[model samples]
Target: MPGPDLLSSQGLRLDGRRPNELRRIKCKLGVFTQPDGSAYLEQGNTKVLAAVYGPHQAAKSKSSTDGVVVNCQYSTATFSTGERKNRPRGDRKSQEMSMHLRQALTAAIKTELYPRSQIDIYVEVLQADGGAYCAGVNAATLALIDAGIPLRAYACACSASMAWRAGQPEPLLDVGHVEEAAGGVVLTVAALPNTGSIALLEMSHRLHMDYFDVVLSRAMQGCRDIEIILDRAVRDHLAEGWTKQDIVTI
Candidate 1:
């Protein structure tokens, strides 16, 4: 059976926002200095951290002549989800996610610029409310920027869901786990928002072809919104110049 009506008669969602509304986004770049680059991002209750390393020579087996090799690893913290994860990495699920992350990021990076070199990106999910993959992608994008990697555009990802309530078809932006678990159709998209190019798209459940356009558009909008938030965070981090404050006396 369908879950509780996701949209009330007042046109507000369970989180008390309009259908196109997105949750609050908080992000920080260069969160870890030990890595070449790193960033932390939080979207609603979902939190993710990403670290980037290299642009250096690839290991013996992974080297390529035509383009740079991008190695990616995705792992979830043991306590990230409601149910604890026993391992942080090497699991089948993490392995698959790592592949997907590599695929998505390769599309945005200008790999040919660093032929025979390599870039390593590692993403860790600190909290998983929903849209963990999307959050990871966004965080990794920022970390790449902090690492000074050239890219075609800012890569962003977001999720959308269809909530038909009161005979109206409403699209939810940036779905949370509660909304995702409701059995509604979910459409996830990773895109270069500035260029309006889609890098990855996946759909869960079923929705009429007519609704595809609406849901896809909503997800794209969410991606664009997320890009703005990330851009602002990057700028803020640069402006702040070391979050730690210490008195200086001459």
Candidate 2:
């Protein structure tokens, strides 16, 4: 079976976006007071929250003298998806997500600046329509910035899928849950959009070798577009947070 249609007659996705357009992104930093840093991110229907704690000492076993140790925990709310009733974390799927989150974040942080220290990041998915992991990575990057951590550049993630439009292969950006469940090949990329260096690349299914480059490029371009949104959010956050209070003499 070719499966359900992922595109409209007008060349829009199920979510009504152009082939290369990303879902709406909105983010805020310092969403919590307890954690060293916190952030919330929304990408279409997917929502993620991230908290960062510690540049504190690492356990001797996990400590590294060459760079900072990065630890990540990934969890999804029980009601995050349509299906309910299950554990949220410590499961096989969560464990795998944790490792992938760590990989993308470690690449952005200037770990060399904090040798023998540890930075712990936790990500929670509040809702998922698609690209939960990508939202997680972007949220963690903002949390790191709010924590005053040094970074070579911001880390951003995006996904791409192929759809048939006018009988031509059209690369879709920011695959949603529907497209993801459609059995299409989904290519996910995490990268430093400024430097255009990939931190992580993953594919859910096989794609033709001939069309592989086009799909990958679309995902990377999505990452870059996401970076622009995130950077603006950070700057706006700084402006609001660092405002100077006027003092008057009585």
Candidate 3:
């Protein structure tokens, strides 16, 4: 159970969104020329930049004969949040986030095709209002595509939270910072919506079993919606004749 005042009398969230609405997502691919692929994405106030390098030779210690190695590094800028603390990239939290990122991305990548190779993905959070991990996953997916990596399907991520409106349990989609801070159950999901598969699922706080399905379903729906948005962005990028070497913006 969360704080009772999560929703307004009219059933709107703190950011004036309905229970099933996602924040506006704006993204651009090929934002940089140095990396093989790069992208910048914004989900409301949350912004992330991702860069992907190689399918090049892997170091002996980290190389795998059976498949390509996917290495990820997740970091938050010093000023990303209001706290403005000097957060080290090798800290425990960043390491965990990096592992989670690698898991979600490896699920989409066709690693078997590039055996004995290595791919590096670096994600940096420029701003975080909530759902920063999800944003990082989304941005990294685009960067991988820009790098011309093969994937089983698009990797999309979204989050959900539980709240009540009109005496009925309502699942909030694409939770923002305010809702997250309200002390409710927050569920984050990363999925391949086109393939009907989930890559990762995480939750903060306990939720009733009865409401669990509903929340999960809502998060999946959000992933599906995000997939559409990302697909459109890809199409538009192609239509604009974007090349990985070209400097472009959208």
Candidate 4:
């Protein structure tokens, strides 16, 4: 449960947003030409980049006759967190995050379309302020789209936190690091918002069953909001053209 001090008397959270408000989202697609597809997304203080590769032949161990295999890797920059980390990858936490990312994205991708092929999606967190996982999911979704990989629907992720203010249960959408560290149950959901299908649902700490619906609903709304932001970014990037410079004779 969250303490009263976490919420201001003016009915605003620490970051000055209403309980259901999400952080600002800014994103760009096809940011790197080197990769098959690449995207960068910023969710408040969190920043993430995702790159997608293939629909090509699968690796020996991962090949499958039934469908394409989706391989995912999640890594964070050394300066991403408040505390500096030594290595970028191969750590226990990174390994676990990579596996979870694979599971969530695999559920949304249309794997059967390319049998014996593989699609690789890698996410790098350049800055973290909580909800890094959600940002990675959104960035990966855009990268996959840029890569021309077929997906059933846009996969998005958002987090919700339970806060009690004045003895009232309030669910906060898109928790930041401060809110997350405030000792409350954080519910992270990855879903296909358009289809109303959930791909992943993870909750930390504990919350009463009665408040679950409200918190889950808030997270779903955040996902929908994020999808709109990402869509706009893709369109904007396309409209901007190749370079910031204008060609032609001065």
Winning model by TM-score? 3
Q: What local distance difference test score does each model get?
A: 0.89, 0.90, 0.93, 0.88
Clashes of 2: 0
| Deviation (Å) of 77 in candidate 2 | 0.8
Global CA lDDT computed for model 1: 0.89
Residue pairs of candidate 1 with colliding backbone atoms:
none
Candidate 3 lDDT, 33-58, residue by residue in tens = 88999999999999999999999999
Model 4 Cα shift for residue 104 (angstroms): 1.7
TM-score of each: 0.93, 0.94, 0.97, 0.93
For candidate 4, give the lDDT of residue 3. 55
Q: For residues 68-181, could you state the per-residue lDDT of candidate 2 as single tens digits?
A: 999999999999999993999999989999999999999999999989999999999999888999999999999999888999999999999988777777889999998899
- Displacement of residue 126 (Cα, Å) in model 2 is 0.7
User: Model 4: how far is 238 from its true place, Å?
Assistant: 3.7
What TM-score does model 4 achieve against the real structure? Answer: 0.93
lDDT of 1 by residue, 1-250 (tens): 2443898888888889789998888888887757788889998999999999989999989999889999999999999999988999999989988987888899999998998899999999999999999999999999999888999999999999988767767788999998998888888899999999999998889888987899899999999999888888888877886532111211
Which pairs, if any, clash in model 2? none
lDDT of 3 at 130: 93
lDDT of 2 at 33: 73
TM-score for candidate 3, please give it: 0.97
- Model 4 regions more than 4 Å off: 240-250
